[model samples]
Target: MIRFYHAPGTRGIRPIWLCEELGIDYGVEMIEFTKEFRASPAWRKISPLGKVPVLVDTADDLLMYESCAMVQYLLDRYGNGQLQPQLGTPEHAIYQQWNWFAESTFARPLGEIVNHGREFPGENLIPAVVAEMQNRGEQCAIAVGEAIADKAFILGDNFSAADINLGYSIMLAERFLSNGLPESIKPYWQRLSSRPAFIRATR
Candidate 1:
């Protein structure tokens, strides 16, 4: 069986939702949110940065960690291209673009906001940094709004792993942005989060 190691309410949610969306028979190991345990020698061998998502494919004796990669693995090996565009197509390129945008662009400032608040809860933390992060996060949200404008999903009428990737970041953005999600973004999130797979993965 496939194994998924994750922590609730973290980036791990992306892979969990992907697995659920795929309907693959897999085992999920819910690790607590603890930096110490993740950074320990044993854990560091698998994940260099003590991240929450680590996937072990016992069937193939494979060890992989990166949530986006896991989603790609599941889709490539098991999906039959159900939730993504056909490889090498123009739409596929768009899919890849949004997936990268989710993690690289949008999630960054949101994570900064979280880290700044978490690492320094009091006035010791610079309010300017937090505000700046929030501003950047909102900017990212605007780009998302433009991308998702009038579309039921990111890549148009179809639902894809890109949605899982982008939607999960949107989930975190909601918490990080003090201004809340833009009106345009809320419906997209509602559509993604309403999935049974999303609900199951979140719990």
Candidate 2:
């Protein structure tokens, strides 16, 4: 069985949601979401940087730390041609683009906001820095809204893993952004959040 070392409300939701969508069996190993635990030698052995959502595929004796990579790995290895476009096609390129954008571009500022708050809390917190990150995150959200303006999903009518990828980042934006999600994104957020798989995985 595939074992997922996870903490609640982390990137682990991405792969766990994919597994739910694909009906794949996996085990969840909840870990303490604390700096001390993450910095421990034992957890470091499993995850070099001590990140949550570490995936251990016992069947292949494989261990993965990156959440998006874990999503792609499960899709390619066990998805059976679901939740993705044909490889090497333009559609797949767009899919990959959005997947990377979801994490790298969209999630970057939100993560910075979080890190800034954690590292510089109380009087040391910088309002301008948080505001700047919020602006960047809002820009990313607007870009997503524009991309899905006339479509049900990022790639026109199809609901691919890109949605799953973006969904988690959007969830973070909703939590972090001071102004909250734009009106353009509310419907899309509702559509993605209402999925049974999403509900199950997140719950």
Candidate 3:
């Protein structure tokens, strides 16, 4: 069985959702972000960064980090080519494109917002940084919305790892939308929230 060390509302959701999609047997160990948990030597051993969503492939004792990499690895190892597009195909290229975009472009900016907000809560100087991050996230959201506006999934017709990657960004955007979001991104959030896998993952 695979062991997943995760935290709620974090990147851990990516692999957890993938596990559900693959119907794979896995064990989840939730890690609290408290000082005590962060200070644990054992947890630090598994993830030097002390981040959640670390997967221990017990069979081979492989420890993996980074949500996108883990999701891609799981799909490649266990999905039997079901949820991933064929390499060298057009669909595969698109899949790889959005997969990287979600992390580098979309999630990175949004994370900056949360990190800045938390690090400097109510600090006047930090508001500018937060606003900049918010703008970047909006741009990313619009791009994602445009890509999936006509299709049901990111990769043409079938659901693929790209969806898993981008879908998580869409979900994160929804949390911020309640406060305020770019008008162009509303429908995109709706489409992602309506997916069955998203519903299951949220629950």
Candidate 4:
């Protein structure tokens, strides 16, 4: 069986949603989101960086930390070619592109905003720094909006795991962006968020 160490509202949603979409049976172990708990030796043994959403495949004696990697792993191992394009194809390349963009590019600034707030709270928070990060995040959001302007999902009409990867980042943008998601992205956002899998994963 696969065991997922998860916390509500965390990146684990990416893999959890994938499991739901593919109808893969899995178990979730909710973890404390508190730093004190995360920093404990017990937690560190499972997650070196004390991050939430550790995936442990007891059947294979495998464990994984990065949430996005977990998503890819599940897709590769159990997806049976469901939510992705053919391997090594241009469409697959674009799929990988969007997945990376969702995490490394788009989620970076939003995470910084979060880190900045945690590191410098209350009056100590720097407005300029937050504004800069917000600008960067918004730029990524605009790029995503334009990319999917005419398509149903990130890679044209098909719904793929790339959507699951990008959806989490969009959720973060909605929470952290000063003005929230731009007007052009609203319809796309509605479509992604309204998906039954997304709703189940989030809940």
Best by lDDT: 2
Off by over 4 Å in 1: none
Error of 4 at 26 (Å): 1.1
Q: Which prediction has more favorable lDDT, 3 or 4?
A: 4
> What value of lDDT does candidate 1 attain over all alpha carbons?
0.87
Ranking by TM-score: 2, 4, 1, 3
Off by over 4 Å in 3: 177-188
Lowest summed lDDT window (length 10), candidate 4: 183-192
Q: What lDDT tens digits, residue by residue, belong to model 1 across residues 40-105?
A: 988788788877688888778888887888888888988887999899999999999999989889
Error of 1 at 166 (Å): 0.5
Candidate 1 Cα RMSD after full superposition onto the native fold (Å)? 1.2
As for candidate 4, its clashing pairs are: none
Each candidate's root-mean-square deviation in Å? 1.2, 0.7, 2.0, 0.9
Better candidate by lDDT, 1 or 3: 1
* Order of the predicted models by lDDT, top scorer first: 2, 4, 1, 3
Candidate 4 TM-score, true structure as reference: 0.98
Residue 89 in candidate 3, Cα distance off native in Å: 2.2
Angstrom error of the Cα, residue 28, model 3: value is 1.0
Which model is ahead, 1 or 3, in terms of TM-score? 1
Residue-wise lDDT of candidate 3 within 69-161, one digit each (tens)?
Answer: 999888888888878878899878878888999888889878877767666767444766767777777778878767766877777678777
Clashing pairs in 1: none
